[model samples]
Target: MVRGVVRPHRVLSGSWGEVIASNLDYHRATFRWKCEGLSEAQLRRRAVPPSELTLLGLMRHLQGVERHWLQRTLAGTTPAFPPYKTYVTAAGDEWYDDSDPTPAREVYEDYVRACQESREVFARATADTARIVPNTEFGATDVRFVLEHVIEEYARHVGHADLLREAIDGSTGE
Candidate 1:
């Protein structure tokens, strides 16, 4: 488990691909920081009465996001170890379903591992690498586009994570 706030390497100077990767890594670290030192109850706490979002849920959702985009979309194959598959099978809204009794640690670990796998996927790719997102409206894309989209996804979710974390413990930071 991550012991404390992880200082992601600064992206002061790099190629376009390196910069994007660094930014994504920063967001991933921030997400982990937001969920750190929280109990299962706190991790599972919804922000509002009707909202299903929770720190744990976000972690699971992001896991699937990384796996789907990189492993499935980019690599054009299914993830060897599909994150939250069992929960998804049981409930269509597995990411938001708090009913599952899965441990918070497991969810966090899965997310971290998925992020690592995503890194591997990108390491084997170049900014200009041709890619076609199957079953999507867009016919074709490239590694750069996928990287940018993932960064945007993390940026949006990190905001949600900030709110959720604050509601859980009144803690806040980038």
Candidate 2:
């Protein structure tokens, strides 16, 4: 789905890069598996009443996350996001806020592209080097640290996807 990284499991040129890349691939596949075989309506169907997480919404939010982390941060862009004030909207502001919004397709497209681009970025980042990263709830370090963060994020979401998928349809597992 992404343009930068293809199969995250394929070994690249470096040992560390290969390990991180593999995790990336693993999460991408896991994410796809969680999202498999559902129509647009099914993807957008909410798991519980008054809750803000539909699979479609989750997908949108994932795209937003990629855009922020890779396209914005990794790419070293100054502005973190668009100038729209609605970026502060609680629910669909970042992900699937709109009920049946037309731009959902666009968000998914951007999401995939961002993932691929991040893969390329990581390759170019000289995975052999070190850098400083901010302190997160998960602790802090640099690029390697961030990659670990990315993997954890994807893993957590994949689990969420599993439960959500089960609720959406009786289907489960890879």
Candidate number achieving the greatest TM-score relative to the actual structure: 1
The list of candidate 1 runs beyond 4 A from truth reads: 81-96, 127-132, 135-139
In candidate 2, position 86 carries an lDDT of: 26
Instruction: RMSD for all candidates, in order, please.
Output: 3.2, 4.8
Please, what is the TM-score per model? 0.84, 0.73
What lDDT score goes with residue 134 in model 2? 45
Clashing pairs in 1: none
Cα lDDT tens digits for candidate 2, 1-174:
232333345555568877677777778767766776667777777776676677766776665566555444444543233222123354533334546465545555656676776676666653444765444344445666666667777877888788888888887774
Cα TM-score of candidate 2: 0.73
Q: What is the C-alpha lDDT of each candidate?
A: 0.76, 0.62
